[model samples]
Target: MLKKVRGTRKKATLGHIRQETVYLAIQALQKDESLSIQLLCEIAGIARSSYYKWLNRKPSACELENEQLTQVMLSIYEKVERTFGYRQLTLHMRKQTGKKINHKRVYRLMKLRGIQSVIRRKRAKYVRSTPQQVAENVLNRKFEATAPNEKWVTNVTEFKYGHGQKAYLSAILDLHDKSIVSYVLGHSNNNPLVFQTLKQALQAAPGSKPMLHSDRGFQYTSLDFKKLLDKNELFQSMSRVGRCIDNGPMESFWGTLKCEKYYLHKYETFQDLKKDVENYIHFYNNERLQAKLNGLSPMEFRNKAA
Candidate 1:
């Protein structure tokens, strides 16, 4: 009779253990972690052998927490406008949560979630203008001059607005000191445009008939432009067709202007663009340092020379 009573107590205890196991498995499933029979057994302090007995069990609290982290990562990617790759996303996560996470983990998450960026292609190419008559290559790529106004190169470039409106920029650069002797902004890039720039340059450098060089653009070949050069007693030089090397200094000036300042900002009106261009030219001459001038600005180097 005592042995039978002991057996009954043992059976009741086993029944209680099974009920607790079922309750833990349900809790694990709600938590969203990888809920398997094995994980549930581990959470409930049961043996692996015992877990296999309940092979069709659900997820535990740990698995649920892992799923929540993934959802949070996805939300972050969406919030950043989908532009951020894994590195940036990882940084964002750390900043938001104050928790340091590995970049590789973030990358893997992004890959699994299929994140990417859109690629853009070039729009159009500029065609070089063909001139009726080519001018002589007088300077022959010699960029240096001993005195101011000895050698000058001129060029014009255009900036576009929405559909049809545009502004033209003409510049005359003194190659000797690499200074912008004169510049003009106009509605059209024509003979009048460049001739006006040349007139200003000639007036600025009084008593000097500089050897002026330019590309074979039509503006440079126009009769009015040539007559003005003749009137000032300045010799005319030109680059060979499609050969930018002949007017390398002027080309370099254009490159520096566009790359350093103009390309970075969008101009709303022609006048605003003109004002900014003037400001940049002033800065280029007076403030901005040039490696070619031994770390001195054009104005500084020229002043020292004087």
Candidate 2:
């Protein structure tokens, strides 16, 4: 009769059995000094042998180390609002501790603790412009540049907000450091948008005669656009027709902007969207680290070069 009762109790607790549940059972055992070990184990759905093993076991060295690291990670995650991935977290840890830390270990710790970065998905870019009146693809998929302002890529992207009113963002990216040299936001994606962006880039670095690259957009092919580049004595290059990949670095920038910043929040007004974009661009330029830039921000990379 006793054995049958024990079996029934064990069966009842089996559905709720877990490591945490076992820990609670241990606490319950301590509170009730008169409870039989066998009866307690039966109620916990654990064998008497398992209970004894757990009761006497000590945490391993690895477990202790992980616990310590977990606390450190929790603090770091909170500091960054939990948006950093393992790669950035690894860098942040080293920067915080002033010691070299292995990224793999950080990855392992994040996995074990169920901590992960905010994931934002990338969107595909739409095709723009006709092929006629275009320059040759002189940039030719050569995205890397050894020095600042040696090569520049420009593109226009649209942001729709507030009853589908569109705002155009025209910007130039330096291939050397992946920094935004200049940008303009306006209601229209016109020649003036691209022209003003170019003028600003030249103003910022007047000495650097960069080879400016862009897709064969109407603005790029416009007489005024070509005249402005000629007046500045800067080289003009365009991507191949129907091939956005030829100008991949600029395309990549657009993808990154949409994924990491734009897509994460909602925009109720044009001003609201513009403000967030401005903030995000500043954050991206100064705070966000790029893997290829030796885990440094764009401004940091340029500062080092300068």
Which of the numbered candidates is closest to the native, going by highest TM-score? 2
**Which 10 consecutive positions of candidate 1 have the poorest summed lDDT?**
116-125
* Candidate 2 structure quality by residue, lDDT tens digits, 1-306: 999999897665453234535655565776777678787777767778877776678978966775776677788787656767888777667766666778877876776556798776555457665544668788899999999999999999988887778889999999998998888889898888888899999999988888999988889988888888888888989887778898898888887787666766678788888897787788778877787898788999999999
lDDT of 1 by residue, 163-280 (tens): 5589989999988679999999999978888888987887897889989999888888777778787888889999887788788888777776765566656887887788879998
Best by lDDT: 2
How far out, in Å, is residue 42 in model 1?
26
| Cα distance off (Å), candidate 1, residue 22 | 47
Clashes of each: 10, 0
lDDT of candidate 1 at residue 46, scale 0 to 100: 66
